[model samples]
Target chain A: MTVQEFYEEVGGDYNEIMTRLRTEERIRKFAGMFTRDESYKALVQCINDGNAEDAFRAAHTMKGMCQNMAFTRLYQSSHEITEVLRGKDLESAKQMLDVVTTDYNLVIAGIEKLLA
Target chain B: METMEKDTILIADDAELNREMIKFIFEEQYNIIEAEDGEQAINAIMENSDKICLMFLDLLMPKKSGLDVLRFMNDADYIDYIPVIMITGEATDETDEKAYEYGASDIIYKPFAPNVVMRRAKNIMELFEHRIYLERKLEKRTRQLRESREKLERNNEFLINALSSVVEFRSLESGEHIQRVKYFTQLFLKYIMKMYPQYGITNEQAILIVNASALHDIGKIAIPDSILLKPGRLTAEEFEEMKKHTIYGCELLEKFKQEDNEFYHYCYDICRHHHERHDGNGYPDQLKGDEIPIWAQIVSVVDVYDALVSKRVYKDPFAVEEAARMIMEGECGIFSPEMIDCFKLAKQELFAVTEGKFSFADVMVK
Candidate 1:
């Protein structure tokens, strides 16, 4: 599948990401790099470990990655959780983590299929 | 002294993805340096401070924060030279203000656009480059100004020596006489300045006085050979003509008088009044008791001291001790009592100069 098709399938913004990366091959390469990014896993582990600060940092980092990739679906959820954790609302962060997880999984799966 | 040919951009962030994104944006133009955490960022800055001209600092890191890096740069004064662009996923007003206060060049919010960040970086680098270029230009101009001033001073010195030598040659005296009088005037002027602050003679004024003393006999250039080069005692008529040398010197300086030139005043005063005495007996103007400028008084005594201690066609050289005693005792020429004290203070140095034991250049260099 094309990178545009993958962004569409994962509910990301193809035009926004293309505005930065320019070429399809460059977009594919950078999009594929997101598969190995551990900010999602880091966020999950920090939330489980009751570490609000590290969890906020991880969520914030993941939000940046999502925005850069134009993964708007995941970026929105990660942004919410990052703000909640920033406000020391670990309980609210845990609840929002579910939505971020669903969005992150969809983007990761699309990147894998696109790269493959 | 560090070279400015650094073509490296340092990407300091804990997130590998962020570092990669930034590297890709600038890879075509710059070599990328990756620092995974804040500690590594500071270490990278320390190791390659000379090689890295720009930095993309992530706000949040494991070991340290972006603010910490800025603080380090501020403490080391590297912030003035290196442009730091802060990149962050989330920045509040307070955090952004704090980053700027810590010397961040610009703040690029996370998911920063390639075009915008590139534009910001280029503009800042251009400003710093222009500032450095202007600074170097100013330094070069300052050096050129100083060199030309020194050259002008050397030319003035050469001109004075040439003019003084002409007068000495015309008077049938050796060339060293003018230089010796100038040296004696310098020594006596300095001693008088130390022993008598009432004169309020600044160092600049003293230097002008010494230079002007060389032209004290400049008037004698107009005197005819019958009066100036007379081998025996001058007749009353020829002695009157010889005394007109002082007035003739002032007339010669008037031909070359320069408006706004402070050096001219000292030259004119010394040439016209070097023969005047404190007791109102010396010519060509007998107005006495401080009527003669203090600088002329200094040149007057030094001129006599030099003449007595040096052999002439008219008389043999007197001993330095005898010359000093004669001046102090008011036997050779009338002088102020305070001037006699200054002469006593300078007797040792004067003797050294007369005996060729010390050169003025050595004293000046020290």
Candidate 2:
């Protein structure tokens, strides 16, 4: 479909979306809180210990913030990741988790952009 | 020096008899943590989060289903990795999948063989250690790389700050635009990275992408204020002139890279091509597909997305979905379908941040 047609289907709610981005300041602050060395390191440790549940959990919590703040891609992928774990799809969970890891850097990149 | 025994297991079962039998099976050989039910299991995990390692959970229990314990742990979101082995009489395919999805390392059937359980647990625990060893090595490499980038962050920051300010100065609009751009870019990048973390873009690369996002409009600095700040719609000529900012930003980044600096290489790619499109319709150079640097592709998408929703002298703010749909529609195939989807996902947050009035520190605090 053409850009205009696609926009017509998906762009129906621009004002609300803008408002959502504006409202995410607190959520962003919450994300920043996770940058702590101890907590961040601990989260990594949880993932490595085969506590896929814990790793998915930590990712879910962060993904939630990304979602509430409208970090759509992050929320979906993180959801996919943890969901795979939640569903017990070990191999796919790892692959999706890798996506979360790579995309997490993107989220951080986005956060850094916001800070700038 | 003796190698520290790293694997520790937590056994959570309602049956005292079962707990005792399993304890006896590995008693002196492995460090063990015991819990009566799901509640205690969770509490024990939270309390001794560090010391006790793997968990051996019984699926059917009095207080909580083995699933509940697994789900709670998945929800708690700890940084450390803890493997779990589910021991249950129910061995249905659904349960098996569910157990693995909930992060169980391995599932063990009850009425069990002690030797079999022990061997499997040991094997899974060994796999966990090997994964951690590789991750540790990667982390060490990352730490080293981050150190090296420290020297470049300062220079790149200076250049970006200077260029972004020049654009801001040219337009009498609040200088907050640069900061806003950075925030939007940061938000979008974080979303994308989390969806695809294999990029191995160091935290430093993240830092650089955000830094460079501000310079998206830096080339506007070279444009005349009369045209740059024009209250009316730009004529075709003026609009073409306006597009020069992308090239301007890229060249400035190129100048910084005169020394073959790795940091500048990143900055150069981002600055030069943030305007390129996925479908080959973007301007300045018309780079397309995988040929475009991913970060720049990300910035290009965000730049327009933000601009569409934000108030501009010539155009009214469009609805978020409309703006998102516009990006997704790809104007003329300018965005990747995958990235378009990614951008669409980020759109909700993008608009929220744009509309929300948050202090810099406030946004950064979390």
Candidate 3:
């Protein structure tokens, strides 16, 4: 899968990511790094442990990465959950978590395919 | 490990991807140094402070926050020279204000465009460079001004020396006689300035009077050699010719006058009136009592004192005690009573300075 095909599968913005990161080679290189980033795993574990503070930080970190990668769908969902978690509204944040999880997994799986 | 010709830029973030991204953006133009957390960032700054030109700090980090690093930079006094641009994904107004208060150079939001980031960093570097350049230029200008002022003062002293010694060189008298007259004049003026504030002479005014005392005998330059160099007592007619030297000194000053109004006034008064006795019997205009300017009176007393105590070709030098007695007793030429008091007050300083190594003190103030 090409970088554009990978972005299409994950519902990310290929043109916007290229504008920031510059070229297809850069996009591919960073996508491989993103696949190994454990912010998604940390977020899941912190939410399960009811650690709203750590969960907020994890979601915030992931939100940054998604924005840098132009994973638009995941960036939007994580950003919302980050706001709810920042407010310490864990119940609402937990409900919003489902949408972020779906987008995060989609991006991760797309990266795996593109890298392979 | 090769030495880099490019300036170094430090990129510090908790996220490896963020550091990598910034490095990629700037590595072509700068030597990139990466830090994984605030602690590492601080250490990197410590190791490469002389090399680092700019820092891109992530506001949130694990070991120490961006705010902590800024505080360290400010405390270390590195904030003024090294510009820091805080890059944050969660750039709230509070954090932004805190970052600036701690002296971050600028703050930019996350996912920044590479071109905008590069331009802003370059602009900040240029501003710091220009400031350093201006500071150096100002220091050099101050040094140059001080040097020129010193040179001007030296030139003034040289010209004063040449003008004052003309008569000494012509009269077959050694330069030491004029120098002793100037020293004794300064000593008397300093004491009078302290004992008698009613005379209202400032230290600057005293120095002017003292410098002009050197020219009191300049008029001797004009007397006919037959009378000026006469080895024995002068006839009344020849004595009359000798007295006109005072008038000749004033004529010479008028022909060579320059822009310094105050200095000319001091030199002119001392030259013409130094011989005027307090009892209305001395020479030229013979202005009696306080009619003589105090500075001229000062020169008059010191001239008598130096002439009395210094050995001349025809006479042996009198003792200091005898010279003091002669001036006060109205024997060597009458002087103002106030000046008689200043003369007694300066007895010790007069001895020390004339006997050669001791310096005059400026301890007196009104």
TM-score of each model's B chain? 0.83, 0.54, 0.70
Candidate 1: stretches off by over 4 Å: A1-14, A31-67, A70-116, B1-6, B37-54, B58-83, B89-105, B185-209, B232-239, B278-283, B286-294, B313-318, B325-346, B361-366
Against the hidden true structure, what lDDT does model 3 obtain?
Answer: 0.83
Which residue pairs clash in candidate 1? none
lDDT of 1 by residue, B1-366 (tens): 534687889999887778888888889998889998889999999999888878999898888988988999999988987889998776689999999999898999877778888889889877776776787888889999999988987778778878989978877676888787888898888888898899899998887788888889899889998778878788899999989989999999999998678799999989999999999999888968778888899899988998899987778989999999999999998998877888898889889988889876555421
- Estimate the overall C-alpha local distance difference test score of candidate 2: 0.66
- lDDT value, residue B153 of candidate 3: 62
- Model 1's CAPRI class? medium
Q: Clashes in each model (backbone N, CA, C under 3 Å)?
A: 0, 83, 0
TM-score: model 2 vs. ground truth: 0.43
* CAPRI category for model 3: medium
Q: Give fnat, all candidates.
A: 0.54, 0.00, 0.49
Better of 2 and 3 by lDDT: 3
> iRMS of candidate 2, one decimal?
19.8
**Per-residue lDDT of candidate 1, residues A8-113 (tens digit):** 9999889988888788988887776778778889998999999999998888888888877888888889889988998979999989988988998898888889
Badly placed stretches (over 4 Å) of model 3 are A5-11, A32-67, A73-114, B1-6, B35-50, B58-81, B88-106, B134-138, B141-145, B177-217, B226-250, B259-309, B313-349, B357-366
lDDT of 3 at B354: 54
